[model samples]
Target: MAADITVIIPARNAAATIGAALASLVPDRSLIREILVIDDGSSDRTVAVAVECAQRHGLPMEAVSVRLDSAGAARNVGIERASGASIFFLDADDQVMPGSLSLLRAALERQSGAGLAIGASIRRTKDRPDKLKTPDGYSPDKRQNTRRYLRNELWPIAMGSALVAKWAAAHIRFPEAIHLDEDTCYWTALLARADAVTIEAPVLVYHHDEERMARRFITAPRGTFLAIARELDRLATAGVERDALQWRKAWIAQRIARQLIKHRMFADAAGMMRAVRAHKELGGSPKALQYRARIHIGRLTGIGAGASPTTHPAMPQRTLIICHDPPFPPTSGADLRNFGNAVAAAAFGPVCLASVAPWNGDAQPVDHDIHVTALTTDSQRQAASLGWRRIKGEARIPRPALTRLKTLVRDFRPDTIVVEGVALFKLLGPSRPLVRQLILDMHNVESDLADQLPRKSIWRPRFSGVRDLERRAAAICDRIWVCSTSDRERLRTLLSKPVPIDVVPNGIPRAEGIPTVLPQPAVSDGFPVILLVGHLGYEPNIDAAERLARTILPRIRARLPAAKLVLAGRSPKPPVRALAGLDGVGLVDSPDDVRPLLASAHLCVIPLAMGGGTRIKILEAMAWGIPVIASPLAVEGLDLTADEEVLLADSDEGLADMAVGLCSDRARMMRLRARAHDVVWGRFGPRAIRDAVRRGLGRNDAGS
Candidate 1:
């Protein structure tokens, strides 16, 4: 119990919070004789604050200000300066919680068996001290007992705010650069050489300020993986056993995957794909490998089909691109911009995208990269107004017209013809045996949508026939692709096909991978900017906008007194247009760009109460590193947690409260942003997705 405990705090400008952090050390003042504050080139009164705080608290604290560029360097400076039997790293923005020092000291006393003692931190609200926000629990203390931790919330072993033996601390120092998750590198380094112990008690209260919190949560995960790769390189330098080191890397990769999934960062599909690849490099187990694969499959199925067409770079692969609309100019969510991109990405040699839409007189410019062909037939033009569709009477192209497609089929000579819906399959003549592959990209189950309509005779029969054709098409196709597993399983039960069904999810084009750093928005321009991004042409999006304007925005404006709603996306129809002139609603119609607007806004809102399929807007917002508040249905396919990355609600009042909660609590907003980015980079990055695509394409690619 009489072991030395060195408290290492890497402080930047801590004039505001250092006193309280130092004051919290009263319990173990005698035992914790060495408290080192590594001040990394502070421009503020941090050194003076630390000195005054130490004297006020009646404790011995040393402040060393090194002119270094990053916090990681500051941590290393503390490690070198400390001479205690144990070491504990704390952040400048956070305060040491009650009983943390004593508990950490006691745990480190038994360091002969364990290298470090890890503790969890609960995030505190910036405005309201009464509200304890964002509590993260650590892995269970029982060593090698991974069962209980898996069943409950378990934080991974990271260096910041965690206690470690001085000897272990000396051996494993923080990387000198990288403002990001430099801690992960240290964690991996420690885990490789030494075993860890996790304490369940709260030890730190991470103050979720705008600047630090946003960078830490959203941008850090990307760099964390980059650092992990660097750590692997370091292991190589240190001459550690390749096999053992790889296992450690795999363990880290697994934890990262779990964290990403837990937060439901739908955009992180790519990162998950990379994790699977990294795990394989580390000699991963079969179970470990499947973790990301299953997630990839889940995300793929969530988007239904015909969101983005993706293909591996190699192999003599053939692809079919299908879309609900003409996809030219790609204005809508399921448009040709994404369709053409996917087709090009998926096809190794030649690709053809077939679409169905209302024929307008305007000439549509087609992309030269991928072959674009439209088959706009009369079946769609037979306006079946609101549930008037009859099963047998459901319009299909006449037999004579079906024969005409033979010429188009003969000319194109496509190996696979990807159809967006069953109607296209019905239009293609059955006599043509030349087409080797028939791929169906079922964007949504027709019956599922029809079932949502008011239960009526016209609706049921029409839906029933559509369902039958859906099943019939499945039997003939070589492979069926859906957006979510929900659709796949639902269709599997309907289809007679023995053919394989897979998911090729919709994906956001990798956004340059650049962090857009902007000054925090104005606090009092009489409007706390509330942003909603999505095409208003969609029923669900329009419904969400209506609800927010009518119900939620008023409540938020009343509470905050300066709240404003920013409606952005393509095509605002008459009803959506009316909300713009309303008191708090500010509409930006069909902006060629929405990213810069999203960055400037205070909060992104997704109050969707209706519709299905994954909302890529949520994913897109997350990828851009913005915090979002969405309904449970809006985040249906995503792995999101309540009060974490998103705030889920049903009622108008509930949604209004969430807006107020996010507005009042900047720390919570920052925490949500961090969690959002972690979900995105961890689950949906391009690298991860590319790997997943390779796997889905029969594991034939070299990357796989």
Candidate 2:
């Protein structure tokens, strides 16, 4: 008797793409006994198209439409309907390339008791006919499955475009109510059942649907939060050790925080906070709680919430803000972060901006009280292109800037040289060992933060650079100020030398010149205006916006047709601006004034995904006295009593449900708005934090 391999296709209306998917698998008919299409109750002709293609191919295919619509549910349905001994899953819009199926099947057959046989993926790009490679030259090897998948690294294994054994499904099925990472849960369960392998050969050719992919983010709102919660719950119930679960949860929470910051999902960011809080509540250690607290503070305040602020030892005449890109241009996300930091530092002293960008012109600063020093070295352009790698170059650090800094140290004889960015601080040589007091204002937790993100560039060099720079700075600097306590703790672990590390949180000088606006009636128009605000060029901000526009917003609208989202921020990229044109999403560039917008707004949100530090947007909204709903990550750092001042949700339904509740209950909204204003003002107010920074630096008065 020939052994049968079940191919499970969990599809939700792929009328335009299902035929191509089915056609691509024709060669694997010998290995695959049946192609089960779990029609997830798609509104379009996806079922009809799948049925027609199944008949045309003469393959054993069945389309099952169930009341449930999630892909995870659909896959479970197909698993129940599957008759084959071995199982493999394919997306309706994705397909297996030539030779991939055989390789996967062979790998599974070869294993003594393997439940999953993972394979690599090729990006079907029109620009590249062959496989797509990452910038670092690594291929999209899905087969290079993380050890966590088997060890339940973060959660369970990931499904969707991988192959599994039927024996695995009998013991474990995709848990109900998982749409975001259903495959992951399934794979994790399978991994727990038996051993697994990562095949080097390509098994799937996943079509790059930029639009569809972008849309999926919005539709699957809060999926990350739910997945994390479920995974943690499973780990707990499965009797996994508390320490092990805490470690995994810490890694997962950071990953979510980074993605929230990268994508800029302000509203959804609160979900990260929820996850961290939940984890801690679930018997997480005190140390784990501290880590979660730091991330939480960073997400809300855009600075260290729990940590004390950096102190200026004495009044300073000048301060230098260092970065790779020139602050003058203010074009990129990195530049904006550098520029904002530079401006903030200027409040303390005369600020000088320096960069490695190739320049022939002399020092000429623009707009703010900043002096620009640009280096026109031979490989400066190439070096600048390398991003974080520019640290490797000998001349990447502007010598002239250093000379000027040293001269300023002697002539102006400033009391403090606050290095705004870690990159700029790394370029500093031992020449200025005698500077009065050196303050390293770290914006991110360098070493471990990157490694914590999902689908990130897995490289030692990137992490090494962060670690080396931090250690060197700790050795030289008199004091350090990190945005998050998580970063402070990570630095403490990495740096053997003990330096006074003060956590001065980021502050958005409470939007000045606006009237002390009274709370207006909750805008009772059917559309619940969900607002997301940030510097949009950042990865987390962009990802959050795109995900919200494509996934979360759509779900909210489907439930309540009038629900709308205001994508408000400064310097939104073309891709970001395009989101406004999308249904239910209203995008705006840096407004002349955001007071009116805030005054009239009913709900304010922060849904950030990829970032190292706290987001000031969350604090700004709360300060404005708007009822705020946010992700756990968004509320990280601040000592927020959840479900009191602000509402928290981690999934699309959770977010929609929260938003709906806040909108429907006028009294609740008003109470939240009032409480939020008090909470933020009492905790994150500029005056209180400035005083805290002074105290941390051991100064009774900053200039005294």
Candidate number with greatest lDDT: 1
lDDT of each: 0.60, 0.59
Off by over 4 Å in 1: 1-314, 336-344, 358-369, 376-413, 428-432, 454-465, 496-498, 509-527, 688-699, 702-704
- lDDT of candidate 1 at residue 255, scale 0 to 100: 54
RMSD per candidate (Å) reads 18.6, 24.2
Task: Give the alpha carbon lDDT tens digit for every residue of 66-120 in model 2.
Answer: 4343576677777778898878888887777776667777877886777667766
How well is each residue in 1-704 modelled by candidate 1, as lDDT tens digits? 55377888888767787777777776768778588988765557988988987888877788875545457878787788788887878777667777786776676555556777777667666675633322244333432222222222345443345777766656677776345446655765564455566566777776655433332332224334445555556754543445554555555555555544543333343464465566455326675556656677767775422221123222233444555466655545666234534433332323545554543424333222245555556564553332323244134433433343466566544445666666455543362364655566666677666665445434345555577777667767767666566767777787775767776554443333224222344344654688887788766677789988888898887888778888887878788999998998888999876767766677777777656522766776776667777778787656667787788887778878888877788787777777776566545444344444444444354432
The per-prediction tally of clashing pairs is 27, 73
Range of the 10 consecutive residues with the lowest summed lDDT in candidate 1: 306-315
